[model samples]
Target: MRKFIILSAFAATLFVSCDDTRKVLHEQYLEYVMHTDSLDVVHDAMTVHHDALKTDTRTLAQKLKDVEETDSIAIADLAKHQVLLKEQATSLSKLKKLIESHADVKSYFMSDSISVEQMEAQLVEMEANNTDIAARLTQIKTELKMIEAEQESLKKTEKH
Candidate 1:
């Protein structure tokens, strides 16, 4: 009878230990997945913002050239170009600030103690803002081209 009791107790202890071990392993796996996701978000955000800044800078330079070359430019038209220039400058400044912030995020993400949830949230918001800025840059380029076309039309009318 004593032998039977000892056998049952040994089996119960083994079962409990196994369950505990499984729980710990599952929790660790989840933590690893979340950490990896956060790192991916930060990396993707940085790449997209870098590409956008490069393209926007090129577009702004071309617009500036057009503004400078405009002949017999009306004061109102010049004012419009100046406003667009100011807007482009502001966008460029914002992009520069984002580049600086990206470095900080990268450093923070490297630490295990940092909150992955908050980092992901911030990265998502930053990506949305960057996309908006890129769209605005495209719109500005289209408007600048329209202005150039109008100036050319005026010149041709004057020639005739």
Candidate 2:
């Protein structure tokens, strides 16, 4: 009777151990899924930002051409546009870096050996970072549009 009791205790311990491991594995899988979803959102936002960047760059180029063609404009006005162009270029460089760094989602996430809690923390942090980057990209694009519109108005005034 004593031996039977000891064996039962050992079996219960093993069963509880297995259950714990399985629970952790399940949690890890869910974290991975959430991580993937966050990455997808980031990718989509970045793509939209990239397209806007391209369009804004083309607008800047056209504005530069217009500024060069018109001799009536004040040097100060041209300089302002030039400075805005430079700022836009700098912002584009930053956007490119952000995109390149996060484009490879696989490297950002670990599939094995990481604890569930760690994975959740990492995912939350990444989502926050991506959100910030998306906001910056949107701001830059809006600034570019405003500058482009101002330049267009300047051109119209010069023509009149």
Question: Candidate 2 on 1-160: residue-level lDDT in tens?
Answer: 9999999999999888866764665565456556545645654655565455446555545655666665444445556656766675676566556544543544334444555565557556555756666676567667656655765676566566
Best TM-score among the predictions, by candidate number? 2
lDDT of 1 by residue, 1-160 (tens): 8999999999999888865654554454345445445544543554454345445444544554466553444434545655655665565566555545545555455444444455556556556655555565556556556655654554454344
lDDT score, candidate 2, position 116: 54
Candidate 2 off by > 4 Å: 1-74, 105-110
Q: What's the distance in Å from true for residue 9, model 2?
A: 12
How do all models score by TM-score?
0.45, 0.52
Please give the lDDT score for candidate 1: 0.54
RMSD to truth, every model: 10.3, 6.1
Off by over 4 Å in 1: 1-73, 154-160
